[model samples]
Target: MKYAPELKRSATIALWLILLTFPIMVIQVNTIENIVVWRWMNIAGVGTVAFVLSFLWQIYQHRKTESPLPVSAHLPAFQRLLADPKLYRPMLIFIAAFALVFPFTASHYQINIMSTALIYIMLGLGLNIEVGLAGLLDLGYVAFYAVGAYSYALLNYHFGLGFWTLLPAGALLAAFFGILVGFPVLRLRGDYLAIVTLAFAEILRLVLENWNALSFGPSGISNIPRPGLFGIELTLEQSAVYMYFLLIALCLLTIFVIYRLQHSRIGRAWVALREDELACQAMGIDKTRAKLTAFALGATWAGMAGVLFAAKTTFINPASFTFMESAMILAIVVLGGMGSIVGVIIAALAIILLPEYLRVLGDYRMLLFGAALIGMMVFRPRGLITPSSRTYVFQPSEHQERT
Candidate 1:
């Protein structure tokens, strides 16, 4: 499945150029009934949309001639994608560039976007561990996030603990809650499973709201401290930039850990359990341990993200950790392509960054975002970056293969 170098380069360049131009197309003009903004060039967003439509039309016109098979009129887009590594390589490069350049860009508004995007990326990774790798559908991921944030705030403000110390403790608390959630519905499956997970997440949220004496109830925690490296506080000039690097490092580390685990015995066990718990159990893989491990590990990431969130914003609220937040994180895992780290990262960025870019589009913004997501899902059901052989190859068994 190889493509010529010239075509590959062209594909990659075009894709990124479109992507890069996309964010700059529309700017928030004003907000009356709806948020509106100024456009960069002449009718910017509209022009961009027209260009994309024209491009798609050209590709469609080539259908039978350049694309294969009767059923493949629509398939060439994806096939061409898989055959060319160039299409997504620029994306990788762009992400790397952004990681290096964005923090240096002196705009508080832009920095806020970067921080939020990083937080969502962390959240997406957490969901990916549960749903993508272990095949567990978590509808209330934000519960763990809430737990982590509150844990740190309560522990630190009340007990006078430091950020470095409470960070791991936050994650551990989230994992403990994950285990609690996992245990109750250990026998549930499919819709039942989803319902239970949702229930668990809501239960936690409700508890936070009602229990005001200790948890601060609905008032939420304010003035949470920013974490400092050694004695160097991040509150100095360019604090966002400092936090940016820290987050990037943490995210990369998390990604590295996930990659290692995905290739390790525990990771394999998760996939096995995902595919068939009964069979996995018969093989003595211990379904209970594997399931709990998946829940715990996933929640740990959520907790860690909470710690970062508390530090950066220096404010906390129950609204931030709603079920909708969980849904958005799960959306990243699904929209990006499950079990594909690269894809998940893209999805996370898109979910967070796209809306900010479309602020100028105002009234039509959400409508357009929803349409684009639906359109992409319809076109690339497997996700923008489908799992390839090199990405995640299932472990084999000779007996099963023979059968």
Candidate 2:
């Protein structure tokens, strides 16, 4: 006897759920004490909920059909206003004004959090070039960020160089390293490329962790200098505000550069490469150059962000550049709609602020966050803010109309 399709699907979903949740629930680590804690109850609760939801969702989808009704055009006044093209400029002006005055009205903690969110926004924009435009699956993008941070850290620690002087230097060095990594993997794509990048990041982490003479091992570099305006050193509150403004500038610069590039010939090539590498190559687009260019440009942004991160934190460590960091940045890009600057800003804000707001959830914060991410992927796989292309209209000639 054969099982029903729904039953088979439910069983498969339940099996996968068990496999994914078992390790995290069954094996827990206490980093401070180096001990393990087991929580079977949590596992059981999560697994049961996941299985039930998956089964119900599958059934609903299977039974669902498309509606025959036409879409409604008579939206609410607020929704209509938002949809109007004429209102875009005014809306943007209002948003900019709000952002400009936010720090003045908000608490110090909120200001600091927004600053952190801006850094991730910068990172998301950088990765958008590689993964979003060029279709490169980079799991080790944080390695470039690590390079940027370490470059500044080493320069400050040894040579006593200031943040301003090292800013471009860090970006240039990271771009150079990007080319070095890109050259070897120019021909690879998809999972193979992802695996290589992941390995590259892990190698960098291990080297930093073990190289005590160079990186100071796990203890990391300390007392990194912050950016000073003119000759005066900024206080802690002043520094936070300063960083916020600096990040806004950097984010704006990123937006301008990406916008210009998106309309340029190189940008078109990148899009073609993303859509179909084989077809792009057949059309005389050099795959090697495009891939390397994307890598270099993307790395440049990550490097700049690293410099700012070092200045803000006044410390650098191997642990700061981890796989989880890469994943977070990737999620920002995906959730924001890849290649969209405005979407990236919104996604970055949500990713950074949502957790802070949900702090009351305690241990359940991560669980809820995971569930939300899953829901987003299921409902809006493309992204929350998909980019739309511009439209052009032309009038027919009088002669053609008469004919």
Best by lDDT: 2
Candidate 2: tens digits of C-alpha lDDT, residues 325-356: 99888998898777777778878998988988
TM per candidate: 0.76, 0.82
Point out where model 1 deviates above 4 Å. Answer: 1-66, 69-97, 233-237, 389-403
Q: Write down the lDDT of every candidate, Cα atoms only.
A: 0.81, 0.86
C-alpha displacement of 247 in model 2, angstroms? 0.5
Model 1: residue 79 alpha-carbon error in angstroms: 10
lDDT of 2 at 160: 87
Please give the range of 10 consecutive residues that has the lowest summed lDDT in model 2.
67-76
Cα deviation of 317 in candidate 1 (Å)? 1.2
In the range 1-403, model 1's lDDT, one tens digit per residue, is 3335434544555556655765556556455668666565634445556555655645555563685676634444644555678875775687689779876765877887888888888888888889988899989889899888988888988898998899899999999999999998788886788778898888888888888887788889998988877786545446777787888988998899998988788988888888888899899898888889999999999999998898888888787878888888988999888887878888899998998899999998888888877877876788767665446568889988999
Candidate 1 least-lDDT 10 residues: 1-10
